[model samples]
Target: MRWMSTVPASDCGRAGTKSSEARLQVDAWVAKRGGERAMAVRARARLVELVAYARTRSPYYRHLYRGLPSKVTELAALPVTDKSQLMAAFDDWVTDPAITLERARAFAEDPALIGRPFGGHYSLSTTSGTTGKRGIFLHDARQWAVTSAMATRMLTGWLTVRDTARIAACGGRTALVVPDDAHVGGAVMAARLRGRSRVAALSVHRPLEELVEALNDLRPAVLAPSASLGVLLAGQAEAGRLRIAPALVCLGAEGLPMAEHARIGRALAGAKVRATYNANECPFLSYSCPAGWLHVNADWAIVEPVDERYRPVPPGEASHTVLLTNLANRIQPILRYDLGDAVTVRPDPCPCGTPGPALRVQGRAADRLTIPGADGTPVTMATRPVAIVLDTVPGLDLFQIVQTGPATLRLRLAPAPGIDPDDLWDTVRARLSGLLVRRHLGHVRLERASERPQISTGGKIRPFIPATTSAKP
Candidate 1:
């Protein structure tokens, strides 16, 4: 707080742009090779520093940590947090006074402000309703620099000398197959990297044939897409319709069966497919090794697998959910925030030889929808972008999508109290049909199921169920 007080809040963002990135990158490089002990030292120092600052600067945290000591090094000493509590008190939750919940939401909804900074120096992004509620986040330049540096460290760990040569041979072009919307993280990243690097964003909403043609022409050296979309492209490549030779197939995916990964590798033949586990909440959460374990980046962030009672689950056991604390993000400090994903920490050291903790996550993989196109051919779409469309619908307490056949879907939903279920269903149908028609699937039939949305054995309700699912819709 003292440091922030020295300069005006608006000017503080500008101060941390270039110099902060260079410094953080250097620190990341050191932490990469410094081993677990070194990382623990840094993590301890950052934990104490951030906790102190958050308790003093953030009004919500100030009251929450009222009785705690001035310095908090142990993460458990802090209470757990989630989206609902913080979002409800959003105006007082942030450290900065300039940010308001309504204005920040308005800024996030504006498509023109996608990659542009808010308050001239903050990165703004909105999350989908996958967690039963939406979220809006802001990252100042300092936090953005740390996120960039952490991602760089992961890239260097995944790519080898041969892969580097392959990237260079193809003019270093990179294509990210993601939804072309401001609310999407991949698009924000692609937009941010335009002049700094060679990157292209191919929207999954485009017709299947068009997406394949665009990839054929780009022939990017590095291709990154959602796991399901990558599999779809693998099929196209095997059919000889897509012909790009990528040295690295980086999947922005997690919790997928190893067979799906192998299928892509077998189809591409020479490309190395790397799986990553990331969320809009914490972008640099973890990355995968050849041993198929996700390694957590614990130097600057804390990951704790907890049970239903918020007790720390022992290693080698699966957890009911996980908690995340982002030491890098100060503008909106995420301290022991409930991320709502199941993960298991490995009891032994990983075979990959990295000293960091290894984890196995569950319930992060989503189903893909294959609807029949107007021409009789089937068109498969990743559930992610489709989520972006449905998440925009307002006033629904619960909703679910179930694909019954090639051209038919069953919808299950519960409207919020005092709202008309029919009106909400109409909005859902119209928006879903609009999305399908835009993707050339106007012939797809939608049905409103009499049954309500059901929870899985995992104790959570999935927003979308695939055609092969045994779950009743």
Candidate 2:
């Protein structure tokens, strides 16, 4: 009987071991209590305490909060601070004065050093800055624990009660499909699943054929991918190539459009499709409720919507910009950080009955583009709307395309290095042109910029901005 019990062959390599039985057991423990109000209560208490600490320890915040609200609740009445202020005082914003921008950059740039904390237990990760400037942030051990709990809630919430059981029984294989490089989320996901031998890390930056093949073969029970990538995979699944019927599909990093959501839902054949609101500036902001409504974590973070004057907007009104205060992370206290993404809190209660506030998020605020039709009419394409089509483009990572003219366009593509720019341009041109007539393709120049692109207030990425409009502005 003892001899009959042997090591499972699936628990072998680094990729395979990423989703092991041991990790799955831990995941079960986390999932069981991840969603309770008690968790949020505990997290909020810690967060309020962290805020007080930041006010004392952080040089930047110490001065910023000089006038002060006596209590943490007074934070809502205070003026909102944008990214510019926090970034301008980059050196003094964090609790640890020793962790400089240079040190953060050095650690983030080194692929080998990722997942290895900065000083003992300090984790570092940077945002893609769909706003203007990319932001670097830090997390400590306690923050990591809260982050883990939040992640469990987001990931496991996608699974049905039945699916959760199947996941546990089938050795619980999970797969994280993202870039192969050291993306902070990818690094965290990889590190979390390191002990799980059944988990596989497949790179979305790979060719479509390769990515699809790997997915069909892996048959991962827990499938987590970016919203755009998930839509593209859904196309493949509809085409009958990718065959895995995942129990859960957790979409993150970018907004999941309605069309793409339906496509993925059909492709997965009743598997739960959900959104995770996370930015490098503030990770684990919210999760999709069982009924598909996004519920703010309100536990580790506070999401405050502000108007033009940085005053709190009414519950139903969309915010001009979002201000976030990250609670669990004291190593780098993020208070009133202006996340360029636009969001509106829904006035009504969620059907899912989650106590947290309900929200409707718009995609990146920088990538909004508009183009002129062949009929001498302007066809406005919002980034959030076109994200449905962009979801189909394979191996496409970060990108920004502005229409230089009706027929001419300037494209800024941050594709995976070595990918053919011509192919991406051709694909984009075809999509943009297919909607318009007599539309001559312009000089789709591929260049790199120092900053990440932004979407407009229209809640979309401007894929093609007419050259004529900028001249007037």
Candidate 3:
């Protein structure tokens, strides 16, 4: 299919802006000769450009690339960077000397600066801090433009011009149901977009009744929520409580099981149910295909599936972890960055005819824990809030909360270096107990686990695990 081929060359180039240039490059990526050969050419070209830029501008990359050949060709030759390593050197990781880790942290911490551009030039967002370290990601005007353009193209893959017009004509309100925290990527994007159009940034942390009321009142045409909460909201829609008929329902941040997807689709009564695979590191990684596969935007971003030893995994097999390199963002060079998401690449091309690799992800499905409510029935608690509490506690690096019984929870924590485990445990227990008490789970017993938390088969450390028939203590 022809993609953006009719667009004039003048339209592609936006007054010589870097972002416009990047967008134009991405536009060309779609028009490139289809298949692996074209992808390799595009990927290599972008990689060389990014590496040269990073080595010259960023101190961290300079040091990391020291002793390496001036012109690097092999991706496997580059060193891998994880959250802990990059964050430890955050001050030197960015290309802009004006952008410091301290300043970025300060900006991210302020609720008032949620959608505001950092230093009037760059947009900022933070990771959920689920993996012990919260990542602060920044995008310059150019990078932001490219990312936005990529997103628009991905949406057009599913949505037609007519569909876009209808949403715009129908008051076009998009409800973003996520944590209210300003530091998150979704919140930051929502806040910036709010300046351009109508967007309701609803918090999942709020009471369900309040969310239902707010959504019903807003009657949004587009409903975007994390996967788990989408399931709950689907129930609300199924019960006729959430009266809004959104033209599109998008789920992100978490996994969407086939059963849950079908349930949501049925509940929405013909609304398009789509899933987007995204992270704060690279917002426009992939979008769901009509065939239900995720086609990676390899031209703008590269994701390498690696085994436990960091060797490249064969297609059709799950990777121990994925390495992501964001070609769109040059301000922060995320070259060969380790993103701990288990993914399986399709060995064959998608039936939907999209170019590039298709992926199946098994990542970040934090299970909900239930406790008896005042009505003597089980009250299901969203795992995100519970996980956030422990994640926010300084010195606690890794943790897992296992519900051993109806009123018992086992907490396993891995404290950061130099942190007192006992002290950290005390803080975690106090904060978690307070949250539980507020949610009518005060009677739940919280115990410390003697063993480290076990990683899931998919190679992820799930923060919350509900007891099941096959659960082990």
Task: Give me the runs in candidate 2 sitting further than 4 Å from their true place.
Answer: 1-48, 69-72, 154-158, 168-170, 365-400, 403-473
What tens-digit string does per-residue lDDT give for candidate 1 at 339-411?
8888999999888876577888886874777766688776777777777766556666667888887788899
> Which window of 10 residues has the lowest lDDT sum in candidate 1?
1-10
Candidate 1 Cα errors over 4 Å, as ranges: 1-15, 374-378, 394-398, 404-406, 413-424, 449-459, 469-473
Steric clash pairs (candidate 1) = none
What C-alpha lDDT do the candidate models reach, one value each? 0.77, 0.60, 0.74
The lDDT, on a scale of 0 to 1, for candidate 3 is: 0.74
Arrange candidates by TM-score, highest first: which order?
1, 3, 2
C-alpha TM-scores of all predictions: 0.90, 0.72, 0.86
Local accuracy of candidate 3 as per-residue lDDT tens digits, 355-466: 7679888755635666666667666676766655554566666888888887889998888789998898899899888877766677889999988777776556666778
Whose TM-score is higher: candidate 1's or candidate 3's? 1
Candidate 2 whole-model C-alpha lDDT, 0 to 1: 0.60
Ranking by lDDT: 1, 3, 2
